[model samples]
Target: MNYDQLMFNINAYKENNQILDLAKFLVYEFELDHPNLEGFGFRDELEKNSILLTANGDIGERQMVLIPRNLFDFEFNLVINMIAHEMLHVRQKSPEMMLEDKNEREWQAYYEMLFHTNFPNVPDVSDYHKKFFAEKALEYYRRMGEGSELQAKYADQKLKVLSLIDNIQHNQA
Candidate 1:
């Protein structure tokens, strides 16, 4: 996908300010560390979907955060939580790390919503949502074990990328 095009479209929407403000708040509250974050944006089409965030490795290290622009119209905190969750994925190195990080982020987001905030009105998520997330995590782990041709091609690439990230972190220390 064209990162610039997506960014432009998102910025063109006037309601994007609310989402951006929520994102800024999350960055501050979570103390998230990101290097390049110029490519994140909210899209209208993703509304009504459970998928809150998605990252495109081919799109200049950018990510797209989707919120139910309508249902979440009153729940801005949830939108911020979703953005933070996706940011964690962008910071991941290995496929193993990606899966682990995403799971942890989801839990963190849910915990914050349930305990940290004082909404005093939000209901607990349905059992279906809980089951779906668990199943998704299992599917991700299964992919790591599969020996498909695509997996074979990317296994070495993933290792190289992870090693480079580790080396950079070591150098910083």
Candidate 2:
């Protein structure tokens, strides 16, 4: 994932009809915006950021999505997932309101991450990080939505998912 190769992929995405296909993928399946993502650039690597959308210009309802090339190593399925995440942000008419509810926002992200990870195909990706990517996060979200204790539910679910994965991964290791 050098700089040149990253640009190559971005260019290839356009030339090979991949960009259009990915844009359609969002529209058809996720009800997300079909982005006109042009090019990526180098930006300060905030430790927590893997990918983010910085708007360059407006094209009707959508803006040109500028990415950070060095932030992530490019993989086809993974890159699609990353773009999909940002598309979620773009689709939000009031992202500031969404951001106000920390639990709901994280719950939605984690809930969606499970789909992107393809738990069956890459189960091990979350084996040691169940709290971040497992059913427990979803369960916590559900309980919190039910008017239960927030922090307690989160704590309980995080450890629960981790423990569940530990049990499942034990002998197979």
What TM-score would every model get versus the actual structure? 0.44, 0.42
lDDT tens readout by residue for model 1, 39-103: 44655555454544654453344444444344244333444445554565555422334434333
Deviation from native of the Cα of residue 50 in model 2, angstroms: 5.5
Residue-wise C-alpha lDDT for candidate 2, range 1-173, written one tens digit per residue: 45577456556656664644434443344344434433333445445535454534332344444555443344444555445555543433133333334455455455444444322222123343433456645654765666556645456545555576577578457
TM-score for candidate 1, residues paired by index? 0.44
Best by TM-score: 1
Error of 2 at 140 (Å): 8.6
lDDT of each candidate versus the true structure: 0.45, 0.47
Question: Highest lDDT among the candidates is held by which one?
Answer: 2
Model 1, position 157, has a per-residue lDDT of 40
- Candidate 1, superposed: residue stretches over 4 Å from native: 1-17, 47-51, 57-71, 74-81, 93-128, 146-173
